[model samples]
Target: MKTTGNTILVTGGGSGIGLALAQRWHDAGNKVIVTGRNAEKLQAAIAGRPNMSAVSLDVTDADAIAAFAKDIVARFPNLNVLVNNAGIMNAEDVSAKRDLTQAEATVVTNILGPVRLIDALVDHLAVQADSAIVNVTSGLAFVPFPKAPTYSATKAAMHSYSVALRIQLEGKVEVIELAPPAVRTDLTPGQSTREGYMPLDDFADEVMTLFAVEPTPEEILVQNVMPLRTAEANGTVPQVLERLKAL
Candidate 1:
């Protein structure tokens, strides 16, 4: 979490929040390699971006992830930071019998994706100096968003896993959970232009400030997310849920 001079790998960096942060880190003097499911898009994202590259990675494919990990490790021997930012969000109505395809995919991409990637890279990271594993969860993890129930659940699971992983790698590696509010990104249709959500640049700027702290915080909670992040602890879950439902 030194904020600079580290080789960082960010998944789902083709667009949205992932790409935004990857660009910021690249600007901050780090060697950044971003990955996504789309090779063309990934290449386009890194076009003309010095010291920044892109690779294709289908997080839903376990075998692919394993192979990608090996190849990436071999290619970037100095890699010490892994950002598990790739995830999917979808809306579903659970009131009646419905196809669970979307829900299932969400679980695979958001939950198992990070687990598999971490499992593949944790050992390599442990031996490297200034190693860190950053998991991008959501504010919905603490307060569920009814519309994207499965997405919310997956993030919640990741938050819990990050906690345990931090304890296990206490001395060897840094485990950080980045819980974002409804930032103006295209995580969902029309979300990028949403009025009530935090601006993408604004969120990334605050995140960079937070990362610059001497002792990097374990949880990166932006101002907009504070209500949701602290809802349960503050006994404001009901209020937060109502507010999110209207979003």
Candidate 2:
């Protein structure tokens, strides 16, 4: 994918990794539109920025996604990049009976949200030059994080989905899966300042650098994430599991 000059739409871009990547793309000369459920947060994210805008969107709403797709295409006809970055993570106890609300919400927002959005915009993207779809999974997808089991499962599903989507869109649209490590972001309470997690700014900087590579990699795996990403293949799952347990 080209590093600049494309109109990009990033979901869940009001804060954290989404906002970071959107800002970097904007700085790189892309017209970036970020969407989030919080209108105020969205506005704040784009404040004092030109060629960067915001729209309110609830990815869990199928009807809203359909409408947003049509409207966005009409507004930015050259929009060719879609970043599926919005996700939620919740710690759940599997040892006892518990409310499934968080689990269900995770499934909808983390898995179905990207699937539906891709369905809505794939046709439009296919017709555009230099089109790309970036699916943000997680390092936990490769190695399940027991504390956020549902969140891990959803990302794992997305990883598989991205593989299939890439094959299906082979010639027309590029499908990239960006699997992040445990970055210090507020995806969960107190995670933003978590001791062991990678700093948000550091992760985002590495990500932007990776994006600048010619013939960009299909999977954007930062150094900090490599352990989790390769644990299974390297036969180090047990060691990785022990490390996660310590966390």
Candidate 3:
């Protein structure tokens, strides 16, 4: 994927990883637009970033998604990059009395949200000379994080969807799956300060470097995420599950 000269839209760009990525893309000379449910946060995120803009979007809202897609394409016809990054992370105790609320939201936002948006924009993307869809999944997809079960499950489903989407869009649009490790971000409350999470700046820089490469790989696996990325292949699911449960 070409790093510059593309109009890119990043969901959940109000803060954390999504914000960091949107900023990086803006700095790299791309026409970057960010979206989130919080209008204030979205505005704040793009503040003073002349090359970037913000739109209020609730990915979980089906009607809003279709309207937003239509408006976005009409407004920014040059758009060619879509980064499906909006998601929610929650820790659930399966053994305890469980409420399906968070899990349902996770499936809707992390899985259905991207699929819906892709359906809305695929036609526009296909007509463009060069286009890319970047899906932000997680390392937990390969090895579930016991506590954040629903979040992990959603990412795993997203990974599978991305694989099929790539094959289907073979020559029309490039599909990239960015599976992140435990990064210093507030994906969950206080997750940013967690002991083993990668420093936000470091992770962001490395990710930008990977994208800068002339031909980006289908999967963007940074060093920290590599272990989990290949965990399934090594028959380490049981071991990884135990470690996560201990946490």
Candidate 4:
């Protein structure tokens, strides 16, 4: 993926990792458009960056996603990059809970949302010269986090989907999975300032550096995530899984 001169659309760009990435791309002379569910948050994100624009979108709404894709294609004809960053994370108890509504919501937002958006935009993307699809998954995908069981499962599903999508679109469009470790974002709330989470700016910087390089279609893993990726490759994933279960 080229770092500059591309019209990029980032979902959930109002805050956290999404906004940080949008800001970085905007600064690098790219036409960046960010989308979110909240109008106020979107406005706030675009206020400081003149090169960035904001669109109101709720990825969970399938009908709204369809409309958004049509409008975006008509409005920004040069759009070649789609960043599937919009997602939700929640903790739920499966044992005591009567309803799995929270888990269902997580599956919808974290898994189906990106799938629907990609389905809606693939045709437009295929026609573009150097199009790319960047899917934002989590380090939890490699090893589940018991506390956020459903959230972790959804990300794992996304990781699987991204691999298949990349293979299918091999020659037509570039598909990249950005599996971030615990980052300093509202997604983890109190844990953002904790010991292990990577700073938002630092994460964004590393991603930009990776993007500057040509089509390397590999998962962009950061700092702490390297150990997990390495362990999985070395067949020590079972041990890592046991450690996470203990957590």
Best by lDDT: 2
Ranking by lDDT: 2, 1, 3, 4
Q: Which stretches of candidate 1 lie over 4 Å from their true place?
A: none
Winner by lDDT between candidate 4 and candidate 1:
1
In the range 55-166, model 1's lDDT, one tens digit per residue, is 8999999999999999999999999999999999999999999999999999999999999999999999999999999999999999999988999999999999999999
Model 1, position 165, has a per-residue lDDT of 98
Candidate 3 TM-score over all chains jointly: 0.97
* Model 4 clashing residue pairs (backbone): none
How do the predictions measure up, each by TM-score?
0.98, 0.99, 0.97, 0.94
lDDT of 2 by residue, 57-79 (tens): 99999999999999999999999
**Pick by lDDT: 2 or 4, better one:** 2
Tell me the lDDT of candidate 3: 0.92
Model 1 pairs in collision? none
Clashes of each: 0, 0, 0, 0
Mark the regions of model 2 whose C-alpha exceeds 4 Å error after superposition: none
Name the lDDT of candidate 1. 0.94
Per-residue lDDT, model 4, residue 231, is: 75
Consecutive 10-residue window with the lowest summed lDDT within model 4: 209-218
